[model samples]
Target: MTRPRLLINFAITADGKTSTVRKDPAHFTSKADLHRLLEIRKRADAILVGRGTLEADEMSLTIPAEHEPAKQPLRCVVSRGGSFDPGHKIFRSKGGAVHLLATDPRPDYDPAVYEKSGATVHTGALPDFLHRLRTEYVVETLLCEGGGSLVRALADLDAIDEINLTFAGHTLFGGQDAPTITGALGEHLPRSLEFELVRFDPQDNGECFLTYERKR
Candidate 1:
């Protein structure tokens, strides 16, 4: 049951959609918000992103020297096939140990891609995989920068501890097909996970930053 403190961070449009139906990059949030993200990243022992997110944003997961984290936060990705472009920046980036969680085994899975890139691959169910993260990586805190489906999986498992969201004002990617912070719930049941709004800061612009903690 030893698990890292899981934190999910994302930005959405005024309409609550994380991205357009095309799943475009959400670069709409302010620069201040980007700095805020790095601040949070500096505190985490590892930063995780889903395969979809990785495909969308070739995230390097490197902490800036100004933040001065004792060491680089481990760069981690979650995917079933353990697939990544060998030339991806995460592999070429200096600092940060690269760790990949192959959450599912695939008939056509190729582990050599990750292994050749110097990434440690862990495989299994989400909950058990996270527990192993704490034991093996000493990951006391893990930050999730997402692509919705992974966040959905964590929420369904009731494993997330905190959510940090930035709502951008005056922007609307209004499409019923667009993605939100959580994608389609794998289960059909309607479940309400309760969270307390711990912080709410509205900026001069129409945007606001929000923090929520799961109710124990």
Candidate 2:
């Protein structure tokens, strides 16, 4: 079970929703929170996200100058199918090497288009891909920024090591179909994994930042 040390970061509304039913970009947090995110990003060897999150956030996946990061983290995206848009912000931006993990490749999918755009595509199940990141890429710390289903998959695998959360109490996206950190409203995880809160920072702007480490 060798893999990178996994960390997940998310911002949730007062009602515990990550996004609206329409799955809009998560821009409701403050400038401070954005700074917080970049600060946290500075600690990772690589940053990962589901393809939907990468597109929805329009993320460049690069460490900005303000952060004065020692180095830009490798930008990684995972998609069930091999479909990826070469025009996405991550592809256009200058960052550490880009990697695409296609857990399920379709017969019609071609990896060349993505390879031409300067990405290395890997095909496998999630756990195997994660192992490759650890052994082949030397990724010691892997940070996962999410779209709920991806997070849910990691949860099912019990691969998450640390959880970072921003609780935005000022906003609420209330809808039965809205998604939470793990995903859609119903159904429990295969089993319970316990974590203990290790950090809690309450800001004046009605946002609270919390960190939890798995209680293994």
Candidate 3:
């Protein structure tokens, strides 16, 4: 059996902030990074994102026309409360499959609505959900495009195998409150996690595309 691999792709500022001072959180990546990001998504078996990311970005989560939409990866969303917007474009696509995971016992959602729109709903523990993806769906490569909270949760669980981080050379200093990529690493990471740098490409916007493989 092929071991499941969880790969996280995100961008941060030079100061390690994933967002800017505006607190809106969209200025972390450059155009070049965006292109590479799409390319990576095209190669994966499945793509996963947190609910907050889905709501905030309103992402279509589809591969562009240059790639075959039918060949695109399965899109999955993790929401504890099953609070995803049914009208989102990602759900509108009938060509690809969509899966929604919620922890709520009686989720306040209409499963038929999403099913009609071409999405499947599942409920279970997060780890078990991922395992099912690997075993049932044959998802060997899982890509995580996220809001910080989801990324942190996955990191805490040690489920991630690799991280593709792009650092934009801009600073978003001084905010009332903002989230960082690493927030308060406690005893869970005592000796500090180690990674091997894989790629570094400089963009016109002074952003650096960096990739790292986690040391097991």
Clash count, one per candidate: 0, 0, 0
* Model 3 weakest 10-residue run by lDDT: 182-191
If scored against the real structure, what TM-score would every candidate get? 0.93, 0.98, 0.87
Task: Give the better candidate number (2 or 3) by TM-score.
Answer: 2
Q: After superposition, how far is residue 77 of candidate 3 from its true place, in Å?
A: 0.4
Ranking by lDDT: 2, 1, 3
lDDT of candidate 3 over 1-216, digit per residue (tens):
233698888787666766543446464566777888888887688999888777777776778887555477888999887877877878766434899998673545767777787688898878888888999999989998876777777776778788888887765443534555643223354346678898877777778888889988
lDDT of 2 by residue, 28-98 (tens): 99988889889889999999999989888898888899779999989989999877887887777889899
Of the two candidates 1 and 3, the one with more favorable TM-score, higher being better, is 1
**Candidate 3 accuracy as TM-score:** 0.87
lDDT of 2: 0.92
Instruction: Rank the models by TM-score, top first.
Output: 2, 1, 3
Error of 1 at 46 (Å): 0.6
lDDT of 1 by residue, 66-105 (tens): 8777778888889877666677888887968888787766
Candidate 1 clashing pairs? none
Global fold similarity of model 1 (TM-score): 0.93
After superposing candidate 3 on the true structure, give the runs of residues whose Cα lies further than 4 Å from its correct spot. Answer: 1-3, 20-28, 67-70, 105-107, 171-176, 182-191
Comparing 1 with 3 on lDDT, the higher-scoring candidate is 1
Best by lDDT: 2
